[model samples]
Each structure stands twice: as structure tokens, then as C-alpha cells.
Target: MSKKKKAKDIMPLLKDEPITEKHIGILEENLQKVPGAGKKGIEKALETLRKLKGAKKDETVNWQTYRNEELKFEFKYPKELDKQFISVVSESWPSWPPKMTIGIDATETDFMCEENPNYKDESGYGERERVKINNAIYCVTSTSGAAAGTKYVNYTYLTIKNSKFITLTFVLSYPNCSNFGEDNKLKKCEAEQKAFDPNKLADQILSTFKFISQ
Candidate 1:
């Protein structure tokens, strides 16, 4: 009889453990090994790692606003479509200080305030919706489209739940500025760069998740 390969025979299988500081530190070291990886380069690399790791957390990201800029991204939880809320906030990109906010519930997420109170008419709104699936939540959200010279931007989001676990995703900016006339053409524009893709962001956001007891 021929011997069969057991599951244990699988080499290089992945684990569900959370990312450790050690892993990030090793990555930093590798970056330094690259040519011309100076202090600034290392710092930028570390910052990128921090952002990537930070996105996986369940806490809200407090951000700052700018003259006329808007940004949106998703915040996911630990575990596969587990019980969690997604947050998508709008703010300036490459922002001196990030203008960010968090909504544990996407359906109720709000639009950001503009610099000028009078600009409210020109400001935008954010939206979120949810659905359920077996043992996992599949969500979708809008991201990245801002009205010129306005602080507020429209947003849409989705959430899903599976059994005892639920997962929520807040898409800050997708399907931007649908309502536009020839005059408002200047007000409506395509999505900005640096904003994470809704679907790709979903995967990346969920990749760093784990279930935590309430």
C-alpha cells in the first residue's frame, strides 16, 4: 500500500496569529539593507508599516481637515466576517494632520464638516448599508470623490453577519458625485489617488483580523 500524505505534511502553511512587532522590525531591517535606505527612507517605511497595522485595529482613527481635501478608507475587525463595525472617514490626503472620523455603524456614518459653515450647502454626505451571510459578513462601501472647495463628501458602506459573528466595512468614497449638471461639472470629479480600492481594501482589512470576546 502507498503511504498517504497527512495534513501535517503541508509545508509552509500559514498561521492565524496576529502580526508581531518583531515582524515589522525585521521588515525595517530589510529596507535598511536596500541601497540608499537612509533615516528618512526607514522612517517612511516604518510609517507605512504603522498605517498598514493600524488599519486592522477596531478603534477609530482621529484625523484633521485641510483647506479643501477629502479622503476615505475602511476599518475592519479581527476574525472572518466576525462581529465588528467598519469605519470610513473623510479628510485631507498627505494631510499635515489627518481629518478622520469613525462610525462603528456604517449605516449611520456621517459626513464631515467643511471649513466654512456657509459651505455646508456645498459639502458632501456619507452612507453605509449592511447584509448578512453564513458565518461571515460581506460588505461594500463608496470611497474617494470630493467637491471642490468643500469639506464634506458623500460616502456609502455595507455590513454583513454570519451566525454569532458580524463584520462591518465603511467605504469612505466610492461612486463619487453621481449627481452633476454641466454647471456642477466643476464640483464633481473622479476619485483621488492613495485611496484604497473597495474590494482590495476589504481583503487587506480582513487579513489582519481575529475574533475578540466582548
Candidate 2:
């Protein structure tokens, strides 16, 4: 007997398919119906779609490449990190992007990274002073041309260890989940999982990270 097909199974068949600008317009219209999905939120979704469309071939990899429960996925990184940090992320949520991506960027002297002290807590959660590291995290998701609408939950974190700047950003995202009314709650659920905390989202950010980059 054959096994039943799952959404995951269908994803790959459609992965390479591109989304059109007209499709993105549909997303913008649907997003307006959801509460709090203002101009900025709609723009965010559109931007994510653009990024996904702009993704090049070499920068792409599969979940199986980095396979592990916490580290069961492959991705493109624009920076180099200590072996330990890389391992931590790989083992923490390797397949986080699932069929999508978790964009990461690391550089030195980014205006944002330099202000660690301001974002840090009294207990020094973010950065003690200035470890001199910068990083960004993002994801791309779309349902359909070159640019499909998308939703991503991202974070920027900085950690300086062993005389090296270690900045790590990981994401859990859903692409092409923007058509709230057209599609089911898949996108909303994905967004909630990444953006909302178990209790209250505001509480989570304040309690855990102390700052919300998004």
C-alpha cells in the first residue's frame, strides 16, 4: 500500500516554481484583512518575497545536506563563525527553514551591533560592552513568479567568545503563507510560532532577548 501524501511531500515538487508580481498583489490585498497587518506588515511580506525571488542558484541548499534533528537542514551563510557557534546553530534547529531559508549576515562595525550596550540588560544579556560583532537573520517564503509574497520571523543576536566575534541569527519561517483568507491558517500559525511566545509576545521578547529587531 502507498502512504498518504503530506504537505511536506508536495513542497519539493513546487519549490523551484517562481511567483509573479500579480501574485504578490494578491497577498497584499489579503494581508490587509488581518488585524494589525498595516502598511508596514504588508511591505514586510512583499520584501520577503523579493528576497526569495532574488535568491541565486549557488546560494541554495537542501534540508538533507545538514541533516540532524536540531541540525537537519542546509543554508547559505554570508559570514564565517567559530566552529562552536556554527555547531550550536546547526544542532539547535538545523531544519528550521524546512523548505525555505534562514538568511544570515555577519560583519564588523554595523551600526546596530555597536549599540549592544543599549540593547543589553542590567545583567548583560545582549552584550557586556562591545564585542565588536554584527549579524542579521531572515527567511524567504512564497507560494507561487519571480517574487512571491512571504512571511518570516527573524532575529539578530551577538555573542563574543574566545577573542572572536560570534554573531548568530536563526529563523523559523513560512513562505507564501500570506494569503490569510485564500490559504488556510498555515502562514498565520508559522508566523505565530516564530513571532509569538508561549504566553505573550511582548513578554517573551522583554524577558528573553530584551530587544526586538523586527
Candidate 3:
């Protein structure tokens, strides 16, 4: 008699097999056998599987390189994503240092959030986390919230090189536009809930970031 397959056995197949509803059905069946596996457990497992698949897909994506000679740094972004450079001016300090802003535009299904002026403190708008790339450490501050009826999520990476600050930001914004008023709000919330994961792409791009030493 053949033995029953476990989630571990099935998980390895995901690397080569295309993920489909059938694959999820198989995972759901095996997830039940996991100790303490509840609704949350199943959801978490599914999320992990999706992200893994996404990373795999990103492996085949064509990426373009962006190099800054003066800053002595470079990074890669998807060829399809738009890149923008902007300068911020401070009112209080005449000697306000120069900073560069890189914005990644959103797709039809996802929204990119821009920087918000109303956020007085970091805690009020975003959370801070640390990430390492190419043996270098960076501080990333991120936030997800709604503004002017539009939903937005953003991540900002900060690092210092040669006594100057280097910042890279990624923003996702979704516009809430529907004629149904409250129903529109509900739909927007639901859309946000179902939006594509942004962190995966962000990580893909950031992984290629490296500081070129002069």
C-alpha cells in the first residue's frame, strides 16, 4: 500500500509545479494535520506559499540598473516599473542638505503611497526595521494607511556613505473612486485587503542595491 503524502512532500513540488487551485487544495488538506493548525495557520501557510511563488516569478523578470556616479551607489529595479528622482527643500534650514527620492509607480491592481506631511512622528505613520544587503546595513521606515480616501503603503531605506545620507523610497497607492459612497468605501477596503504583496518586489529591488566605493 502506498503511504499518504504530507505537506512537506508537497511543498517541494511547488518549486517546479505551477501553483493552482488544485495545489492549494492539497496544502489545505495537509495543513489540517499540522499541530495547532487553525484558520490562522492555514492563512499563514497560504501567504508563505504565495510569496515563495512570487519570488520565483521575479527571478525571471528583466531588471534595469540605476547608477549614481556622484553618490557612488547603484541599484536595480524592474524594467517595467517607473523611476523618478526628486529633491526635497526644507523651509527652516537654508543649508538643508540634498536628498534624492526614488518613486516606484504602482500597477493597476496595487497602490503606492507617497510621503505624508501630516505625520509628525515616525510612530504615527510608519514603523522602522533593519535590513542587510551586500554586507551593508540599512534602516527602513515604512507605513500603510489611508489619506484623502486613497490607500497607500510606503517604505523608505536610509544609509550613510562618505558622511552623507542616502535615502531610497518605495510607495504604493490605491485610489478609492466609486459612486456608491459607503459601498465604495467597503469595496476599497476589500481591494486593499486583496491587493498584491508589495514587499516581495521591494525586497527584490533592494537586494541589488550596493554602494560603489570611490
Q: Which regions of candidate 2 are displaced past 4 Å?
A: 1-112, 115-147, 152-155, 175-178, 182-214
lDDT by residue (tens digit), candidate 3, 37-100: 3445455657767777566444524676778897567777654433121112234222122224
Q: Give each model's whole-structure lDDT.
A: 0.36, 0.35, 0.53
Q: Report the lDDT tens digits of candidate 2 across residue range 162-184.
A: 22233334433334444555554
Question: What TM-score, to 2 decimals, does candidate 3 have?
Answer: 0.41
Query: CA lDDT of 172 in candidate 3?
Result: 55
Q: Which has the higher lDDT value, candidate number 2 or candidate number 3?
A: 3
Tens digits of per-residue lDDT for model 1, 57-147: 5322332212222313323332222111222442343221222233353332332222222222223333333433333344333333454
Please tell me which model should have the higher TM-score, number 2 or number 3: 3
Off by over 4 Å in 1: 1-145, 149-167, 171-196
User: Between prediction 1 and prediction 2, which has the larger lDDT?
Assistant: 1
Ranking by lDDT: 3, 1, 2
